[model samples]
Structures are given as C-alpha cells and as structure tokens.
Target: MDTDIFSLRGRNIVVTGAAEGLGRTFALAFARRGAFVACVDIDPAVEETCALIEKNGGKALPLMADVSNEAAVTTMAAQLEASADTLHVLVNNAGIAIPPGRLLDVSVANWDRVIATNLRSVFLCSKALLPMLLRSKDASIINLSSFLALVGLYPGFEITAIPYASSKAGVDGFTRQLAIEYARDGLRVNAIAPGWHGGTRLGRERQASSEPAVIKRFNDFIQGSIPMGHMGTPDDLTGLAVYLASSASRYVTGQTFAHDGGLTAA
Candidate 1:
C-alpha cells in the first residue's frame, strides 16, 4: 500500500555499459529517481553519461573498465568502496554480438570471446561486488539477457549471431544459480530479456535500410509480429528495473522477466 516502497533515494547503483543505448537509459532513470549512479563503460562516453546525470541534478560517477576483465571489475568494487560504503544495485548490461555465423562456422576463439563478454563479465562483476551488496540491507543484481534466449529468435534481428543467443541463454542460467546462492544474503539476482527496440541491431534494420520501401517492410514485419502492435522503448523497461532494484521486489528473486512485447509469447 505504501507507494514509497519503490523509492531509490540515497541508494548507490552501478550500471555497466552506460555510455549509450539501454545502459545509458537505465543510468539516467535511476539517477532521476534519486539514486547515486555509477556509470561504467569501456568507452570514454561514459563520462558523458555521468555529466548528463549531474546536469539533471542527480549524483553520478564515471568508471571506465572492461567488465570481462577480473582486475578491472575488482577495481570498480574498490572504487565503489571509496565513493560509497554500500552498493544497493548492480546492472550488468555490457554485451556484444558475435559474428553472424552458425554453430559450425563460429570459431572456438569467437565462442570464447562471446562467453567472456556476455556471461563471464556478469560473474566477475557480481563476484567482485558481492561483499558490498551483502553489506546492504537490500541489494539487487539485474543481468541483461535477450528474448532470443527465450525463443531463439534471430533471423529478423539485425544483430544476428549464434554466440549472442547462446551467451544470453547462459546469462539466464547464471542468474538462477546466483540467486539461490545469495538468497540468504538478501541479494536478489534476476534478469531482463528485452524485445525489439529502435536503436539496437534489429531496431536499426527498420531505420537504416537501403531504401524506404525496404525499411517500411521491416517495420511492417515487426508490427505484425509483436502482439503489442509495435516494439518497446528504453523507458518501457524503467519501471520494471526500478521495481526489481527497490524493496518493492524484496519478495522476488531468481527470476528472468521478459520485456519483449509478447515476442517470446507468440
């Protein structure tokens, strides 16, 4: 009954790959809602994410690091300790699309790279921050997965890669195991599987086509495919992210909530 149960005021949150796209959106959303956001990205643009937050009257810290590197992740944890004694939320959003190739075509090296980027980074970051999260009264870890993990949908996707799908599926599995291991610590681990958006690989297909007619064709395809009659926006996910990061979801743990406008349902 208390509406304030979702407030993120005074909480310190870290979001990886916050330089742009969904990661930037999540960082800004949390900062606007009153949380001190630590924007982490391998790109220098991560500083821009921090500036945007500060410009909006929110607190932010810019951290540049490769999430896949254990040492870099450990440094982030140490930085958090220096900036904020506790970490309330961690959103592991750094990921990449492997070369578009079938299982047989995908090289062993590419396979390892995809695993390192998509799955290993989540483990390294979560492991590094576990102690800090455990020290908090309420802590949450959100792993970014994909609807492809749910239904193996990729033909229409712009970022078509066999490894991409495989890696996301692994994220789903990792989230489940971590949730169980840390449940007693009051650390809730979960994942979000996003649907089509306008900027991602698939999203760009509808925008940067060779011709207007081709672009319209792609748009029509998605519109007809999704039950919602369209795709989703970054803002469309903010509420769910806020819920899982707040006390509102204290009773929830070890779950992967798909935000794909029924893409996986159909």
Candidate 2:
C-alpha cells in the first residue's frame, strides 16, 4: 500500500487542548506527516508542544487561549489568519471532566464547566473557523467524543462521569448535524470515541496523589473490563486522526469511530 495516501503534506491543522495528552500527541503526529500544525490550548504548555514539533523539523504555531471564550476564539482565528490563510483541519479536542459521578457527585459548577469546555468550544471553534476551513478544497473537523457516550457503565467503567459522558454525547450529535449542514460546503465532520487510555494529563493531580496500591487496583479493574486486556495509549489515535484529517477519508463523514480496542464491540 502506498503510505503516501495518508500524508498530510502542506495541510494546515488546528488542534485544541494540545498542551498535553491526546491533543499534544495529535499535533505532533500531524506535524510529522508534514502538516503545518497550530497547537491551541488554554495552557501555555502548548508552547512546549509546538517547540517539540519544531525540534523535529516540523512547523507549528502555538496559540494559547480559552477555547470556551468567544473573544478568545475570535482572537485565535484572527491570529491564525494572520499566520496562514487556509485551515484544512480542526481537531476539537479541548475538554474537561471533573467533579464526576451521578447527580450526588456532580455539581452545577462542574456540569457547567464540562459543557462549556467540551460542548460549547466545539461549536465556537468550528463556527469561528468555518470561513477559513471553507477556503480549503478539502476540509475536515474531527471532534473528540468518548465511549461513555454510547454506554452507561459503573463499578468498572466510567464510574461517576455523568458530565463527561453527557458532553461527549452532545459532541456526537453535533458531529452528525454539522456534517449534514456542511456537506454542500465541502466539509467532512466526524468524531473519535476513545476508551480506557492512559498517560493523559486529565486527573493528573489525582493520580499523582494516589497510593500505589490504590492506583494498581484501579488499573487492574479497568483493564479487566476491556476485552483487549489492556488500556490504549495516546499514540493509538494517530492513524485514525491522520486519516480523517487527510483526503483518505474524503467519502467519510458524520461517523464516530470508537478506537476502544474492541470494548465497544461487547
């Protein structure tokens, strides 16, 4: 097979939440494939992501802004416009999952925070970048949903993660609707619903504070539930992300691919 089919050469890609974890990994993956990457994140650590990309002889633009803020998003768009004229891909990966659990554990503040970051930012970034994206002959928007959106699990799976699940479910709906609405405009919208992944910055503080025994038990239980007998890694998403961002998926849109190591199959 000609791997050239998967190349993102000369394409411009914008990745939010790119300071750490999957977002940062995605930015590097795209950069390695010759895409000019824009690493967007609320955290200034996004600069570090871009620096690493540049160190690898790849081009990257670091933009720090709260994706959930309208003025910030607009300013980000303007800054990006000044740097590059066309945006071929937008990865809406910025999100937060905190104060998790059912109604008893979920607070109004936490619910609102999760929605604003996960759901509203997708809307804001996509809408704000439509003009830039429309200028490209082939444009793709890949939103990050999650396995929790498709199933409700407890004890072993996503315990007390209602806000996270809800936000991702909303992402799925948005992906489908936006794809339908923008078909004529030549934009392909899709999503990725990932399952049990590790090395993510989310809940980093908690993990850091966890006792070794507690963490081990948690890991064992979660991995036992996954049919694959293990968890996925940040690098696992590279191919799917690159494919969706490239012409390889020209005929695909409005679909959500679960990169869950067959967990969703059960």
Cα lDDT of all candidates, in order?
A: 0.86, 0.91
lDDT of 2 by residue, 1-266 (tens): 33687899989999999999999999999999999999999898999999999999999999989999999999999999999999999999998878435667777888899999999999999999999999997899999999988888777433446888899999999999999999988899999999878887764644775678767876787777789888888899899999999989999999999998888897
The list of candidate 2 runs beyond 4 A from truth reads 1-3, 156-158, 203-206, 209-214
Q: Native-vs-model 2 lDDT?
A: 0.91
User: For every model shown, what is its TM-score relative to the native structure?
Assistant: 0.91, 0.95
How far residue 48's Cα lies from its native spot in candidate 2, in Å, is 0.8
User: Between which residue pairs do clashes occur in model 1?
Assistant: none
Give the distance in Å from residue 262's predicted Cα in candidate 1 to where it truly belongs: 1.0
Write candidate 1's Cα lDDT for 38-99 as tens digits. Answer: 99989999999999999999999999999999999999889878999899999999887654
Clashes of each: 0, 1
